[model samples]
Target chain A: MKIKREYMELGALATLALVLLVAFPLLLGGFYLNLAGKYLSFAFVAIGIVLTWGYGGILSLGQGIFFGLGGYALAMFLKIEASGSNLPDFMIWSGIKVMPAWWAPFSNIYITLAAIVLIPATMAFVFSYLVFKKRVSGVYFAIVTLALALTFTVLLVGQQSYTGGENGITNFTTFLGYDIYSHASTYAIYYTEIVLLLFVAMGSTAVIRSRLGNVVIAIRDREDRVRFSGYNTAAIKAFIFMLGALFASIGGAFFTIQAGLISPTVVGVTSSIEMVVYAAVGGRLSVPGAVLGALVVGFLQFYLSNNFPHIWLFFLGALFILVVTAMPNGLMGLLDRFALSRE
Target chain B: MELMQGQQGVIFDGANVPAARRGHCELSIRNLSVSFDGFKAVDDLSLHIAQDELRVIIGPNGAGKTTLLDMICGKTRPMAGQIFLNDLNLTNLSDFNIVRAGVGRKFQNPSVYEDLSVAENLEISIPRGRGALASLFFRRTKVVKEEIRDMARIVFLDDLLDRRAGHLSHGQKQWLEIGMLLMQAPKLLLLDEPVAGMSPREREQTAELLKVLSVGRSVVVIEHDMDFVRSIAHTVTVLHQGRLLVEGSADEVQADPRVIDVYLGH
Candidate 1:
């Protein structure tokens, strides 16, 4: 009976995929479709938050660091390709006569793709492993990650010559010589992002259902007990944290593609906290709920900011407060309660 | 004194004699000492546990009984001591490594994963697939399921396998924890007040369970209930103020002047 409930949840995910794959493209126009793509990109981060925060019980307040790393990785490649044999325009403007050795690696598409995933994953693993090894967790771990976000943003903004400085890496028009702004390419990217998001969600679900997932949950609850059970609780947490970073990095790469830029603004302390809000509002424990949360919250932010620009931040704060205090389980919890009542 | 298999199948009458003469010791602690703020919690404690022996430790409050177990399980690093499981030095090993080295410890409180199902609680304790990646891909085979079921039966939780651990009664939770330890198949088990909250009926069952569990391994239990100690203990070791006062049968310890002075008299 319990297993059936799990399968039913998977069925809900399949239904969600069908709606994203079919319904959204049919109903929404080009601009709305693009906006939807952007929100879906954020869903990557939300899914990651679900895994790390919801399941593994590691609340990372610096996911923006990984997101920025991924965005910058892909943006660097695009900027180099667009520059075509000259230093990227920012470097030239900053009086850099030669391409930095680090920038050279981004020029290769394969290396850029690999870097987008690997860099954030390695950083997350090493950082979390060291911290968890020393038994630093709970709010302390969160503070460390928050500081990481702040530090990353400062470094990005300070590196004017190599990283494009406060303006960030932008004005890239093509990916591998194809026109990215063209209507067909936009639709193509949107479809690719949707498919990848669904795949990631499925993978996350499989992991949550696995034995490792059980151990992660156990560690979250009674870490000492799990340790006494002969499991390396630190390594388990690090692995999940790394997976979360991997997902966020992929999302950042997609955001760079869909939004056409990467900036410190999108990869700072505020943005990282906002990423967690997406998970919290969506239902941290539910993978599909995370995607829905990103979309709903993303759309609300867009709509509210357009209409009442100055009040949007306050509105977001209120919503977060409401969710945490009144509905701690988020939208998924509500849906679950509703379903249970109906049954 | 000669070693004999009692009605319980394994019982040591005089384990205080040096362990080298009677086969091999399963756990050896030598001159273990630890102090906090100039106050010794466990001081100069040297003890040996033999194979297939169920030893009960009876002590008053602040007697360092739990602290001694903590040192054995690597939860507490002794200022000076050596702990050995056979020939393996366990004093410096981390908690998880010490657990892997064949020592299972149950805390004073029931510490089962309350949110997990009884089956999941047992399954997570299986010694295989301990690595992060290994566990990610670990499968529940038929053999594993059967093993879980058999263990549940032993702990008298077979019917509650699918129930959430939080919903279980106190005695059930304690049994689930012991079941978890049995899943590790540790050579030495350290249990602190295993029946602290159990009813008299549950206490009787736990005593039986401990006797059955000690057949192939060494079991050390700390208890205040003298009746429970007499029921399951092969030999009794008494600790008072971070030191061993006496080691003997329950009847002998009950008659000892030192044991009566520090503990039983109260």
Candidate 2:
């Protein structure tokens, strides 16, 4: 009977894939399709949050740090490709006569792709391992991650010459000598993003269904019991945290690709908290729900900000409060309740 | 005694023998001491538990019964002492490593994973795939499934296998935790007040369960209920002010003046 529910979840994922891959492309215009691609990028972070916060009981308020790391890693490669033989335009303007040594590795596409995942994963592992090993968790861990996001933003903004500062790395005309801005390329990129998103969703589902996922859930509820059960609770938590970072980084890379830029504003503390909101509104336990959450919330944010720019923040705040108080499980929880009552 | 039938391995029959005379004890604690700030929670305590013996430790609230279990299970580091489980020194090891070394502890509270099903709780407690990577790739083999089912039956939870642990009655939750520990197949089991919240009938059933469980392994329990202790304990150790007050048959300990003065009389 429990297995049946899992299959039903997989069916929902299939339905979601059909909508994203076929229905959206058929129904929406080119502009809306591109916008949908951007929302899907944020969905990656929301899915990662589901694993870390919803299941692992490790609420990281600093996910933007990993996301930024991934975005910046890919953006550096894109910027290098756009600049061709000269220093990136921002570096030239900032009076930097030569490319920084750190940026040299990202100039290679393979190295950049590896760094997009590895850098964030390594950082998250080391940080989480050190903290969790000390048995620091709950609100204290959350605060530490929040501080990390703040510190990361300050560091990026402070180092203007190398990082492109607050304005961030932008104005990418080409990716590997191909005009990325062309209509055909844009559609291609959108389709590629959809495929990658579905692949990641499947991977996340597999992890959630595995024994490791059970351990993660167990740790979330009774960490001491898990430790007494002959498992190193800290190591398990750190591994899951690293996995979440890996997902966020991939999303960050995708975000940079779709949005055409990477900025401190997009990867700062506020943005990290907003990413958590996407998970919360989607139903943090459901992978497909997270994707739906990102799309629905992302579209709402766009519409509200455009129509009622001054009150959008208040509206978002109200929505979050409403979800937490009335529907702790988010949209998926609501849907499940409806389904259960119907049955 | 009939519960001892069909048991394998060495079953130590000399429950009354002195610690120095025993050839090999399953658990040996020597001069164990721990202090929080300047207060000694457990002070200069030494004890021995023989294989297949069911020993119950009874004490007043502050007499360090739970603290002794804590130190033995590696939750609390002793300021001074050595804890030996067979040949291995468990004093300095981490809690999980101690568990891996074949010691299972049930806390005072029924600390089973409430969100998980009864079967999953048992499955997670199985000895294999304890490492992070190992757990990620761990499969539910037929042997593992049988083990879980057998353990559920032992704990009287076979019918509730798919039920969420949170929904179980308090006594059922306690049994689930015991079943979880059994899944580890530990050489030594430390239970802190196993029947703390159980009803009269549940307590009697637990007593029977413990007798059957003690056939092949050592069991140390901390309990407040004297009747429950009398029913299951092969030997009772009375602790007073972080020191051993008495060690004898349940009736002898109940009759001891020091044990009564410090614990039961109050």
lDDT of 1 by residue, A1-343 (tens): 4675697678779988988999999999888998999888889999999999999899999999898988899999888888988889999998999889988988889999999888999999998999999999999999999998999999999998988888888999899989888988889999999999999999999999888989999998989889999998999999999999999999999999889899999999999999999999989999999999999999999999999988888999999999999998899878877776786
lDDT of 2 by residue, A1-343 (tens): 4675687689889999999988999998888888888888989899999999999989999999999999999899999999989999999998999889999988899999989878999999998999999999999999999999999999999999999999998998788788887888778888988898898899889888888889999999889889999999999999999988998999999889889999999999999999999999988998998999999988999999999999998999999999899999999889877766775
In model 2 chain A, the worst 10-residue window by lDDT is: A1-10
Candidate 2's C-alpha runs over 4 A off are A1-4, B1-25
- Reference-based TM-score of each model: 0.96, 0.94
How do the residues B1-266 of candidate 2 rate in per-residue lDDT, one tens digit apiece? Answer: 21112132212332333434433348999999988988888889999998879999999989999999999999999999999998999989999999998899999999998888999999888888988889888998876777677778778898999999999999999999998988887778999999988999999999998987776578999999999999999999998878888999999999998888888988
The TM-score between candidate 1 and the true structure equals 0.96
Tell me the deviation in Å of residue A328 in model 1.
0.5
For model 1, the local distance difference test gives: 0.90
lDDT of each: 0.90, 0.89
